[model samples]
Target: MDKERLPRWGWLLAGLFVAALVANLLNLFVLVPTVFPEEYRAVTVITTMSPVLIYVGVWYDEHRQHYWEQSGAHIAGDVLFVVTGAALGSAIVLVAIIDFGIPAFLREVLAMGAGFLMSWGLFWWRNPDVYADESAR
Candidate 1:
């Protein structure tokens, strides 16, 4: 369907998913590792970026007029999504910190896979059609 026809809340979730995936990957792989080796400082970046991503996602959702009125569930879901992303990034760091338990290539793969699965599950569970249908009933 076209942009106008897309459900407002669905679009909002979609945008958040995309932003979280991009930001988490870029920061975890490229930015953090490049700037601050594998110390506590690097893990700090991974954990801290989660809330930052959520805030930025919310700000973009507001400016973009994506979702319907903000709801408690939406905010909760956003937090969940960000936490999942942060955990994935942190897992990679753990692998590196523990003597490269996970190979370099596998770390990137795991991060992307986790991001996709988390986003997909959250979006599926909170689908806008289900919300609308329930309200109509």
Candidate 2:
């Protein structure tokens, strides 16, 4: 494992996280929302998936490769950190954008973008199970 690189599973998780983020942002921010749908349920679903994908990727990596021993309380900790960080980050930004009357697409982009970034940050900081090296960048 290299300190300068993310684990394979980490890369996969990051890819999914970015893909979802980009899809949601492009849907409303770049493309016409009406062309997709009146309701943004898909966007909501996508926004909320950041933590799940990260957790699954990390858990699967640990389970299959035995990178580290993370179970029970540790698993719960990861869930808590990732989910709370993303949720709170998204909520705070969402409220601010809604209050300021920002454009709908920008709101989605900002909120969901915050969520994904927070989720990734928390996971990277609080847990090193997904990192190949202790000095991971």
Candidate 3:
């Protein structure tokens, strides 16, 4: 198989990593939350959906095409992206916990959600072609 046709998980991972880094830096320097605190749960829901979305897209792609195509790569990329987001998020959370004390439960959840979303959004942006193709099917 031509390697160019393969799904580029590395791009997704890199994009997510960059996004997390930027968002966190913005949050830290600006002293403001990047995502709406009230929508934290919603953010979590969206971020959590990344793997499931990639899996379904891959499963369908493989079944339809008789070969795993972009889906598998997409899933792998998303995993790396998620890990990056989680690690970066954990660091931010630790800082918040140490400096401001534990936030209210909802706020804590939202902060994490924001981190996840930051990564997920980057993945979506970097892999627009795959996402667009998956949606068209």
Which structure is stronger by TM-score: 1 or 2? 2
Off by over 4 Å in 2: 1-47, 59-64, 133-137
Q: Show pairs that collide, candidate 3.
A: none
Steric collisions counted per model: 0, 0, 0
The 10-residue segment with the lowest total lDDT in model 1: 39-48
Estimated TM-score for each candidate = 0.37, 0.55, 0.40
- Give per-residue CA lDDT, model 3, range 93-126, as digits (tens): 5445544654556555655565556565665665
Question: lDDT rank, highest first?
Answer: 2, 1, 3
Supply candidate 3's per-residue lDDT for 95. Answer: 46
How large is the C-alpha RMSD of every model relative to the true structure?
8.4, 8.0, 11.6
- Model 2, 61-129: lDDT tens per residue? 544345246577876786788777776777677766676767778887787788878878887887655
Q: Considering only N, C-alpha and C atoms within 3 Å, which residue pairs clash in candidate 1?
A: none
Model 2 TM-score, all chains together: 0.55
Best by TM-score: 2
**By the TM-score metric, which is better: model 1 or model 3?**
3
For model 2, what is the error of residue 19's alpha carbon versus the real structure, in angstroms, after optimal superposition? 14
